[model samples]
Target: MTFTYQMTVEDAVSFQKELIHHTEEHERRRKVWMKYMRAILIGIGYVGTLFFPYRPESTALHILTAVTVGFLFALLLTPLLNDLYAPYMLRLNRRFLQKSQTWPKETTLQFYETHVEVHSVSTNIHRTTQVPWASIKKVNEDETYRFLYYEEDEALIIPKARQGISEAEQLEIDQTLEKYLSTSPNV
Candidate 1:
């Protein structure tokens, strides 16, 4: 499940907005729950101390305990919170990029996109590789996999389950993206 398309900041922002608007209820619920959990943890740290003060070995120990507990909890929760709010963060980033008039910076995704070919080996090996479309000699997609080629050489192989878009709709979407890439303004 892979797509190759080029887009600018405006397109990215518009796409993000549409995605947010169309996201499933379960995802929204999970995001809300993650926020609640983070708030609860922070509240517990402060509120619990009020109800049951920590009797430190000394003043230094008291300060250390407070800092340690607070920092530890914050460190642990930050990633969790980020994971939960990733979609929202992506939208925010897209919006920021659009506002800043930086198309390239905005359109440059963290993930790589290139023509790829998928292959399977009986040996103990599994990896995804990027192959430029110009170098691609072939391309194939099935219900379960997508294979790309590079001038008689095969490139990346990806499982359908991992594609971000629906399998049923991927082929159509990919074709549309391929068309868009040719005309879309590069960031």
Candidate 2:
């Protein structure tokens, strides 16, 4: 089975955001302290807000209020800041971080019994890569995309929209992945 689709910078940014969100969720799940800390911070902020106008003379309460406000600001602003920064980061990655100047505009994925072949085409170049089933570290899906993670941070992003793929093709791709990936030790 084969699938081809266009990939834009927006797709890259969306993938990055999703990856970051997933990583954050995983960390939040793995680190029990982080969950407790967030709860404690919220509690402090709520309590401090209630007491802030009532008892201005309490030095410890004042300190707690200041700390809580600062922490809350940081927590709230981090995601907003990341949203603003992601596009620039993606641009920088395309221009300097990548080995090739020509980014993949159109990608073709050919799924075989044992491996998958990726063909990426840009204005200046055409590149082909083969990834064995054993090398695929993970397979992830969201509402808009299917991610085949070959490395820890790298993935072949496949859009789930009705671009060119039919339902039958999608099902076939899913079955092929499950067939190979289930047998592979890495995935």
Candidate 3:
């Protein structure tokens, strides 16, 4: 499948939102859970007189406070952490946009069995590259777009409304990517 298109910050913003939704569920939860677990262990060690010069009676109070504060902070800050990611990603992509000016604004994407080929053609820029399926970190789809996250803080955003990319064609592209890329996309 091949599609040709241009990009904008709005496109980048939409993809960033969906990507954050996916990461919050699959990635952030695990990290927060691990931190809480570590806090519990550290609290226990403190109570056991392993590090602090405190009596057994005072150690319990200190452990309880440590555990409470740690768990509460972890639970309360998940959204803040998730929210921070989007703006950071937007900033990074905006920076990428600055660099993108040197390359062609028009992009052609070719999806293959084992890899995807991207070629850009412009007055002064003619760039061609192949990205293997394994390098794609994730795929995401929503009502208006499909994002092929193939690099750190970067994605190939394909608008469903783009010319020549019909509903059926978009579905085919999604399925092809799901099969060849890392895993089934977050639809």
Which candidate wins on TM-score? 2
Q: After superposing candidate 2 on the true structure, give the runs of residues whose Cα lies further than 4 Å from its correct spot.
A: 24-104, 183-187
Two-way lDDT contest, 1 vs 3, winner: 3
Alpha-carbon lDDT, every model: 0.48, 0.68, 0.67
What TM-score do all the candidates reach, one by one? 0.29, 0.58, 0.50
TM-score preference between candidates 1 and 3, better one? 3
The collision pairs in model 2 are none
Candidate 2 accuracy as lDDT: 0.68
lDDT of 3 by residue, 1-187 (tens): 7887765556656776676566545366546655665665555543454454553467577667656655565556656655665566667766776566553257788988788887766658787878787887877788888777777556667677776577788788767766787567677
**Top lDDT: which candidate number?**
2
Listed per model in order, the count of residue pairs whose N, CA or C atoms clash below 3 Å is 7, 0, 0
Across residues 42-87, which tens digit of lDDT does each residue of candidate 1 receive? 6666445544454766767765666566556766877867665656
For model 2, what is the error of residue 20's alpha carbon versus the real structure, in angstroms, after optimal superposition? 0.9
What would the C-alpha RMSD of candidate 2 be, to one decimal place? Answer: 7.3
Provide the lDDT at 174 for model 3: 63
Assess candidate 3 and give its lDDT: 0.67
RMSD in order of candidates: 15.3, 7.3, 8.2
List where candidate 1 sits over 4 angstroms from the true fold: 1-11, 14-57, 97-187
